[model samples]
Target chain A: MFGFCADPDTLGNVAWMACYLTTGKHMAIYLSVGTVLLLLAITAPAALAFGFAGASAARSRILPLSWLGRGYIAVVRGVPDIAFFLFFVIALDQFFEWIRHEVKCPDWDQPIRQGNDFVVCAEAKLPLGNAAQWVHETYGFFLAVLTFAIVFGAFAANVLYGAMRAVPRAQMETAEAYGMSPRQCYWRILVPQMWVYALPGLSNLWMVLIKATPLLFLLGVEDIVYWARELGGAKTARFTDYPHGDWRMWYFLALLVFYLLFTRVSEIVLDRIMKRLTHGQATSGGEAQRKAA
Target chain B: MSCLQTIADYGLRSIGIGERLLPREDFTLCQQFTLIGSGMIWNVYFGLIALLTGFFLATAVALGKASSNPLARKPSEWFIFVFRGSPLFIQFFFAYFAFLSLKSVSPIFDPFTSAWLGAAIVLFLNTAAYSGEIFYGALLSIPKGDTEAADAYGFSGLTKFRKITWPTMLRLAWPAYTNEAIFLFHATTLVYFSGFPAWRQKGDALYYANYFADKTFNPFVPYPILAGYFILVTLVIITVFGLVNRRLNRHLPQESRGRLKMRMNLIR
Candidate 1:
């Protein structure tokens, strides 16, 4: 914020706009975009890890593990993801808090669920009741990221499962002919080759994951959507530095353009990545590139 | 009240036919089930209507995009890109505000502020763009032999399309289109969550589920009920689409007709 922003009311239109955009709240709102990016950064790898585990579990020789993996993948088959986002935030929160309640409040006797209220002991509250405000927000964001990771992990698993199966049987057989164990074949041959198949699905999933970041607001994180609504509302003359009528439409429009640009950039980047990954592979994409060369 | 009476009262509550006020306390499983089931009507309404209406628009847009004409192709391409690129959630919010802003200038645009019309239009356009892209891809893939055969029969333009090109496109696009419909249904949950306000507490299944979750502070129960309802709905869509897929592929040789497997990874 510039020093001239000290008296925003008298500034010209351009100066006022500059001061308005650089307000502390606006800075927080700008940082909320980072919150979204950070969420995507965090959730992408977490979901991939979860997906890898789920895919491996499904492909396992053990019956129970396979069933559990299959169940996890099937969880997304029916329900809308927003439901899971909403459900898991509470369900996961309670599960953790309830665990803490058991450990931290062994002497407490009251039921955790008292009719309508979920009255966990004070000590069991996430981030502890006495913790700083930022700690509570961080806890919420962690839960939301976990929720995103869990839900999208199922989708990633579904994609990875197909990619794993799509790895031609001949490839795996040849690896076996070399006397490599199943595990070695899986890691060396199948895993490396699966990326070519998975890239398309994974790229699409990445797009979905990017789009889903807005739902972080519903999880109570002060993400872009939250900030947009907060900052873009009609600000009365007396209440704020610069008075503005309903500017939510403009705010949302900005978000729309931001998303459009993000997706466009992602598409270009992913296309290049796809080309890079497909090289020397046996898939159609690879086959075409070989022919082109 | 008995479960039967409660159902009779709250069964149509989502549509505002019965039960002026939702249950405040001591929520029963029956009430959660009934209300959430009632709320499902909105989901079905939004999904079916959007898909049906979008079908025609998608067909046109697909053709337009496939056209060699720059004028027709450019707008069609841009429409698809804009809708397909961004999040539907943001689209709803942005569209709602856009419509709200319009309410001042033109009285005719007043009703666009409501969820039923405003949100439905966004969902409809959103789906059309997606399906259009799918259809356009399928359209391009229609075997040259088939079109050559149509030309040999002295058929051209719309005649060739209605009889030959259209059926093949639908058949080819059917599997992906099924996935599109599934995602569209899942997307209807965002309507209430976005800027569109649910009038008189009337909302889709997720809305009622969220409500019960908030009130009872026990999300484990209601959300699962919502999920169960959705799973059934997904099955119904798949079955209906599967039958149509069969009819479209009726002329194809037996082995060539790919079975309709519900693949989970759909572009949202």
Candidate 2:
């Protein structure tokens, strides 16, 4: 990162620290922060879409759709989500490979599951056996994002379901009186109105999503946690320049602070958004605003 | 081996009792159930102990946050923010590493590096912070008239708290606190997965489940069994908390009593 980092062994303490911080592994750690942010950027809206679908389905008058949606929400409940994280990644991966095997290698005589090993045909591999390393990493990350979206979507559905219910019944009744169909009433009235009600819960879920990014490490992504563990482990003098004792505590401390600040900033922003949403609304917040005015 | 023999061999395996070596291959349904069920002992141990110990600290934290004194208020606020803001996953890692360093500093801190003491401490602090926030909200929402009534009755401090304020807070906070308790128990699965090593293969339910999944390369079986155990634990927690919630709300009329609802507050 700097010219003084040319020879790490000969560098002064501060320069050595700078070089160490700018090393390839450290760069990976920094890049992995971007990975965490990218995951949040992608997962938030994806989960919201899933949540909206789930909430809508759960609210459907149709019996099976409602059952499907309600079951989606209920089953994810009570169970440890880490189990989902662990289970879905493998299960989804296998499901995809199995599908690919069925389509691409119908002639393959070998059973996909032979005892403990799940051996799909070579062409049926997720990224294919011959794919670049980056493709494999991206495939893993994609699986992770999908898993996150699925799990958090269930949570969001619960929130949105409540928020939809919390919308004033009079508004929907008014819509009905105006001859709006059920679908129209839902989109034109309920969807827009539910945001204010959902904001608090959605914001709470956002914080949770932010905190959960660390779990990406468990899913085989070289995420921030992975990097922190990798780079912060004690390095022997024989290994390379800038060897140091265990610094995992410090690295984790940095991560803790990063999360703290991220959540704090998010809370402040969410508070502002909530204030804005409630500005002219008929809820208690609006009532208080009117009184203050 | 017979099912009873399997149970007798692997039932207490999680606490490092009967089995010297985990079954390696040709996994049976019986082995999965027995081993994972045995592992639930650790989960129960972690959750119950952490919840029990964290309860007192949570109350203190809640009071501190609600206190007017900045000296108390600032630390309490920060404590809640730090613990609540960060993932418990990170907390476990940070704590494990911190304990390792502490262990190096003095042999007296040796046991702190182990999951039993170290992870429990992290879970303890983590749950305390969460419950503190819940209790603080309940404190703020405590009806003003209730306190005025207490004042009129010449009650103050500990006497007033024990007689009126505490009960009201617990009653109000019970539903949310129940959700927190459930999630905290769920959060216990992350213990062995984090930096703390599960000594001698004695691990939580998720640990055994992961082992089975790895051994079998079939997540279809063990993960569901693990989830089933957790669901069972969740039901038990709800029943116990529901009983307490009922006791707390006993004075209220049947129609006016607060009902337990499962609000989705996923992850700490």
**What does chain B score (TM) in every candidate?**
0.98, 0.98
Ten contiguous residues with the weakest lDDT in model 2 chain B:
B259-268
How many angstroms is the interface RMSD of candidate 2? 1.0
TM per candidate comes to: 0.97, 0.98
Q: Which ten residues in a row have the lowest lDDT in candidate 2 chain A?
A: A73-82
Q: Give the CA lDDT, 0 to 100, for residue B57 in model 2.
A: 96
Computed on alpha carbons, the lDDT of every model, listed in order, comes to 0.91, 0.93
Q: What is the Å distance of residue A227 in model 1 from its true position? A: 0.8
The digit string of per-residue lDDT tens for model 1 on B21-44 reads 999999999999999999999999
Write model 2 residue lDDT over B73-111, tens digit each, in one string: 999999999999998999999999999998888999999
- Model 1 chain A lDDT-worst window of ten: A74-83
Candidate 1: lDDT of A245? 88
- Candidate no. 2 TM-score: 0.98
Off-target runs (Cα >4 Å) in candidate 1 are none
Model 2 lDDT, residue B181, Cα: 92
